[model samples]
Every structure is written in structure tokens, then in C-alpha cells.
Target: MKVLIKLFATFRNERFKQEEKELPEGTTIRQVVAQLEIAEEALGMVMVNGRHAPLESQLHEGDTLALFPLVGGG
Candidate 1:
């Protein structure tokens, strides 16, 4: 399956801001995160096709996945 991935904030450092990726069928959001080497604790939000999704959510072809890193401020 082919899906579009969007990275936001510090997550984009050393990585692409947006790109289309070829993922195997039955892939889950959590798998993609690991593939990108993104630590679970550092993730702030996960979205699929503009809707919030859980880490175990299954991704389909043409899906758009967006990853955002946790934001911290005083």
C-alpha cells in the first residue's frame, strides 16, 4: 500500500516534512513510527486522513498519516 506521511515540528529534523511511502499491507501506525525511528514518548499526536488515530490503527492505501512531536514550554 502507498501512503502519504507528514512530519511536523521537531519530528521533521533530519527527516522529510512530507513524503509518499510504500508500506506493506496490514501496516499499523505504530509500525510506521518504528520504521521512522520515532520514540513513542516523543510523539504528541497521530492522525490519519485528518482524523486522530491510535498507534495500533491499521493504515490503508492512499491514507495520509501525520506525526507531530510533543511540545513543551514553560
Candidate 2:
């Protein structure tokens, strides 16, 4: 299955802004994140095709996955 991945905020540092990836069928959001070397606790939000999804959410072909890192502000 092919999916588009988008990284936001600090997650983009030393990483790509977005890219298309060919993942195995039944790949979960957590699996992709792990593959990217991103810690689960470091994520602030996860989205699939613009809808909020959980880490255990399974990805589908042509799905758009977006990842946001935890942010801190005054």
C-alpha cells in the first residue's frame, strides 16, 4: 500500500516535509512513526486523510498520514 506522509513542526527537522511511502498492508500509524525513528510519546497529533486517528489506526492505500510533534509555548 502506498501512503503520503506529512511531518509538522519539530518533526520536520532533519526530516522531510512530506513524501510518498510504500508500506506493507495493515501498517498502523504507530508502525510508520516507529519506522521514521520518531518516539510515540513525542507526537502531539496524528491524522489520516485529514481526520484525527489513533496510533493503532491501520493505513490504507493512498491514505494521507500527517504527524505533529509535541510543542511547548509560554
Candidate 3:
């Protein structure tokens, strides 16, 4: 399956702020993280298809995925 990924914040800077990516079928968010070679800690906030999702969330074809570093500060 193909999944569209949006990166934000420091994670974006590290990953070159890729707008989209195609993932394999049955790939989980964790897997995507690894595939993209993102730092483990960079798998911060996750949204799948516009809904909050966990790292274990499985990706589906045409799914829109967004990821950002853990938001901090006041």
C-alpha cells in the first residue's frame, strides 16, 4: 500500500521535510519510521488519515500520515 507522509518541526529538518512517501502493504507506523530511517525518538505525534494514531497504527493505501517531533515548551 502507498501512504502519504508529512513531516514537521525538527523531525522535518532531519528528514528533509518529505511531503509524501509510499509504504508497503501492512506496514505499521513504526515500520515506516524505520524505513524512512527516522530517529526512534522522532516518531512523535502521529496522525493517520487526519486522525490521531499510534506508532502501531497500520498504514493502508492512499492513507495520509503526518508526523512531528514531540511538542514542547510553554
Candidate 4:
């Protein structure tokens, strides 16, 4: 399966802002994050095809996955 991955905030420093990746049929969000070398604790929000998604959510071909890092402000 192929999915589009979008990284936000500081996460883009580690990975591309957006890119397409080919993964196994049963690949999950956590697997993709792990492959990107992103720490679990750094993840803030996850979205799949415009809907909120969990780390365990399974990915599908043509799906768009967006990841954001926790942000802090005064």
C-alpha cells in the first residue's frame, strides 16, 4: 500500500514536509512513525484522510497521513 505522509512543525526537520511511502498491507501509523525515527513521546496529533487517527490505525493505499508535534506557547 502507498500512503502520503505530511509532517508538521519540528517534525519536518527530521522528515520531509510531505512524501509518499510504500508500506506493507497491514502497516500501522506506529510503524510508519518508527520508520521515520520519530519518538512516540514527540507525537501530538495524528490524522488519516482528514479524520483523527490513533497510532495503531492501519494505513491503506492512497490514504493521507498527517503528523504533528506537540507545541507549546506562552
Candidate 5:
């Protein structure tokens, strides 16, 4: 299956704004992020189709996945 990924903020700096990734059926969000080498601390929030999703959320073909990095402040 093909998944569309969008990286925001720092993540965008590391990865491109939009990317296409291939995965077998039943790939979870966690697995994809790990496969992409995204740091755990860098993962602030996960959004699937514009809604918040957990790491265990199963990915569907042609789904738009967006990941935002954690923004720290004093």
C-alpha cells in the first residue's frame, strides 16, 4: 500500500514536506515513523486525515498522514 506523509516544523527540516512511502498491509503509524527514523522525542502529535491518531493507528491506502514535532518553550 502507498501512504502519503507530511512533516511539519522540525520534522520538515529532517524530512521533506511531502513524501510517499510503501508498506505492506496492516502497517501501523508507529512502524512507519520508526521505519522513517523519526526520533521519539521529536514526535509531538500524529494526525490522520486531519484528526489526532495514536501510534497504533492502522494506516489505510492513500491516507494523508501528518506529523508535527514537539515545540518546547521556557
Candidate 6:
């Protein structure tokens, strides 16, 4: 299956702002993060197909997943 991943904030520094990824059936949000080398703790919010999603959320073909990293500022 294939899914679209959108990275926000600092997450985009070392990765594409948005990209398509191919994965086997039953891939989860956590797996995608790991595949991209993103620390789990660095993630702030997750959305799948525009709805809030959890780390264990399963990804499906054509799903658009957005990831936001924790933002810090003084």
C-alpha cells in the first residue's frame, strides 16, 4: 500500500515536506516514524486523513498522514 506523509516544523529540516511512501499492508504510524528515523518523543501531533491519529493507527493506501514535531521557543 502507499500513503502520503506530510512533515511539519523541524521535522521538515532533514526530510521532505511531503512524500509518498510504500509499505506492506498493516503498517502503523509508529512504523512510519521509525522508517523515517524520527524519534517518537519528538512527535507532537498526528493526523490521518485529517482526523487525529495515534501512534498505533494503521495506515491504508492513499491515506494522507500529517506529522507535527514538538515546537519549543522562549
Reference-based TM-score of each model? 0.98, 0.96, 0.79, 0.95, 0.90, 0.94
- Clash pairs (backbone) in predicted model 3: 1-25
Candidate 3 stretches with Cα past 4 Å from truth are: none
lDDT of residue 55 for candidate 1? 100
Candidate 3: residue 67 lDDT (0-100) = 79
Instruction: Give the winner by lDDT: 1 or 4.
Output: 1
Give candidate 2's total backbone clashes.
Answer: 0
lDDT against the true structure, each candidate: 0.98, 0.95, 0.78, 0.94, 0.90, 0.93
Name the top TM-score candidate: 1
Off by over 4 Å in 5: none
- Residue pairs in clash, model 5: none
The window of 10 residues in a row where model 3 has the poorest summed lDDT is 14-23
- Candidate 4 residues 30-72, lDDT tens each? 9999999999999989999999999999999999999999988
TM-score of 4: 0.95
For candidate 2, the per-residue lDDT at 58 reads 98
Candidate 2 or 6, higher TM-score? 2
Where does candidate 1 clash, by residue pair? Answer: none
Misplaced by over 4 Å in model 4 are none
lDDT of 5 by residue, 1-74 (tens): 99999998888765699998888999999998898789877889999999999999999999989999898999
Worst 10 residues of 5 by lDDT: 6-15
Give the clash count for model 5.
0
Q: Which predicted model would earn the best lDDT?
A: 1
**Candidate that beats the other on lDDT, 2 or 4, i.e. the better one:** 2
Candidate 1 C-alpha lDDT tens digits along 1-74: 99999999998899999999999999999999999999999999999999999999999999999999999999
Model 6, position 51, has a per-residue lDDT of: 95
